[model samples]
Target chain A: EAGVAQSPRYKIIEKRQSVAFWCNPISGHATLYWYQQILGQGPKLLIQFQNNGVVDDSQLPKDRFSAERLKGVDSTLKIQPAKLEDSAVYLCASSSGLVFSYEQYFGPGTRLTVT
Target chain B: AQTVTQSQPEMSVQEAETVTLSCTYDTSESDYYLFWYKQPPSRQMILVIRQEAYKQQNATENRFSVNFQKAAKSFSLKISDSQLGDAAMYFCIWGANTPLVFGKGTRLSVIA
Candidate 1:
């Protein structure tokens, strides 16, 4: 089965510029997530959506980060007026949501660099 | 909030040898899932193995296995007969009703 898919495998932008990342989840998966991985740390969830509705986004930076899942299948994460500190690997993951364990399938992340 | 911790930042092993990475977590929930994910240089996080808190027997997947101690909130991954392909960043994660919380990750290197 095809795993979660993300676009723009790499991105470079200047501070205050706007950048967006897109994700296409595996068919039939009900849960989608966006995470940010700093150079030396594990990925942290930026937002989560269950089907078309958002489930959690407490960790998201409301001032600069935003994400949406349209039709519950494809999702997009955006960072407007980016800062140098925002440079990191943006990862997209999806899960079947059928069982408790909910094994997640990850996409090849989009590495973003804000200079 | 739940948190995962990987104490070892880096580990190295000779080819065909064994290496173990340590992880510990803090959580109030009794039953949840724990996972070990491998991220190669290519940067795709892949599931290496997983353990359910309710299961007493350790979860094993081929040469990769987990030692899960629920009472102590400790989980560790052991790679047996390690190969160069096993070199990657290993992350310990705690899964529950909320999004999975990940540790900083342990980078493993295999020397041939």
Candidate 2:
């Protein structure tokens, strides 16, 4: 019954720094997702994981953005050498990963600021 | 690739009034899912409603309902008897054969 949980509700770092965020999906959830939301924009999927394996990462900035969902329940998203453009909210979500339509439960996103 | 568009960047409505938010998306898949999410200042994304492409009848939840025009690629959210709590940024999203994609979003303001 618990919702998706995220750590480090807020973070501030300078350009060229590195930042990491953690997420704990709901119990028994098989799919995890990380998204980035810039001001005045909608959230964009950075990566998706199905039980510890990546389902999609085509939109991810592979050079700088990396995410892993180890053990299939918890996920971590990292941004190395964070750029000013990377200043946004990092959102974690999870779903049933079933064939039918399932809603994703979102966490109180981590707000990251890169100066 | 799938793309979502929310042409109205902002809208305002008085309390107890009704408002509609427009959304459109492009997709090649015949069966997929469309959703509307609301994000308030607290920064948590909340699901408002969803529509399935395979279903012809529209979906409704309490005071929230959707007008799904599959051929026109239009999905709109209509909130009846809007309240101040309805003030937030609404995002239109779709996931076809690919991953989910969200639109720029429309900010709604409720004037008491």
Candidate 3:
């Protein structure tokens, strides 16, 4: 089976610019997540989606950051008017479903460098 | 709210030796999951091992094993017969749903 797929492994943008990252999760997977990993820190959950609906996004910066899992197969994370503090690796992960305890499959994250 | 902690900022081990990474967590839920994820230079978070809180027997995968102490709220990873490829940042995580809480990872270096 194919692993989670992400586009534009590295991105560079100026502060206040808008940037978007895409993720295509493993086929048949029902849950998808987006996380941010700053240097010397662990990945922080940004948002989570179960199928086409969001499960949790309490930690997300709703003022600037937004994500959507359209059609429940692929998802996208966007940061409008990005800040310098947002310069970190954005990771995408997916799991099988709610009942099973399948391990999360992660993709090669998109490293966003805001100058 | 659940939180994971990894006090070790960095650790090193010799090839063929064993090294243990310590992790402690805080949670109120009786049923949850613990995980060890490895992130190498490629930047992909790979699942190394996982354990259910209710399970008594430790979970082991290949040369990797977990020492899960539910009472103490501690979970640690022990790597036996360490290899050069094992050198990476290992993150301990806990959660029940899509959002997982991770500890500050421990960077492990293996000497050849």
Interface RMSD of each: 1.7, 2.1, 2.2
Worst 10 residues of 3 chain A by lDDT: A95-104
Q: Provide per-model DockQ scores.
A: 0.72, 0.65, 0.67
Q: Could you tell me the TM-score of chain A in candidate 2? A: 0.96
- TM-score of chain A considered alone, across all candidate predictions: 0.96, 0.96, 0.96
TM-score of 2: 0.95
Positional deviation of residue B23's Cα in model 1 after best superposition, in angstroms: 0.6
Docking class of 2: medium
Instruction: Give per-residue CA lDDT, model 1, range A1-115, as digits (tens).
Output: 8878999999999999999999999999998989999999999888889999888898999999999998999999999989999999999999887443777899999999999
Model 1: clashing residue pairs?
A: none
Residue-level lDDT for B2 in candidate 2 = 78
Residue range A1-115, candidate 3, lDDT tens digits: 8889998899999999999999999999998989999998999889888899988899999999999998999999999999999999999999896642678899999999999
Q: Which sequence of candidate numbers ranks them by DockQ, best first?
A: 1, 3, 2
Candidate 2, which segments miss by more than 4 Å at Cα? none
Query: Of the pair 1 and 2, which is ahead by lDDT?
Result: 1
After superposing candidate 1, which stretches have Cα over 4 Å from the reference?
A98-100
CA RMSD of each candidate after superposition: 1.3, 1.4, 1.4
Instruction: Give the Å shift of residue B35 in candidate 3.
Output: 0.9
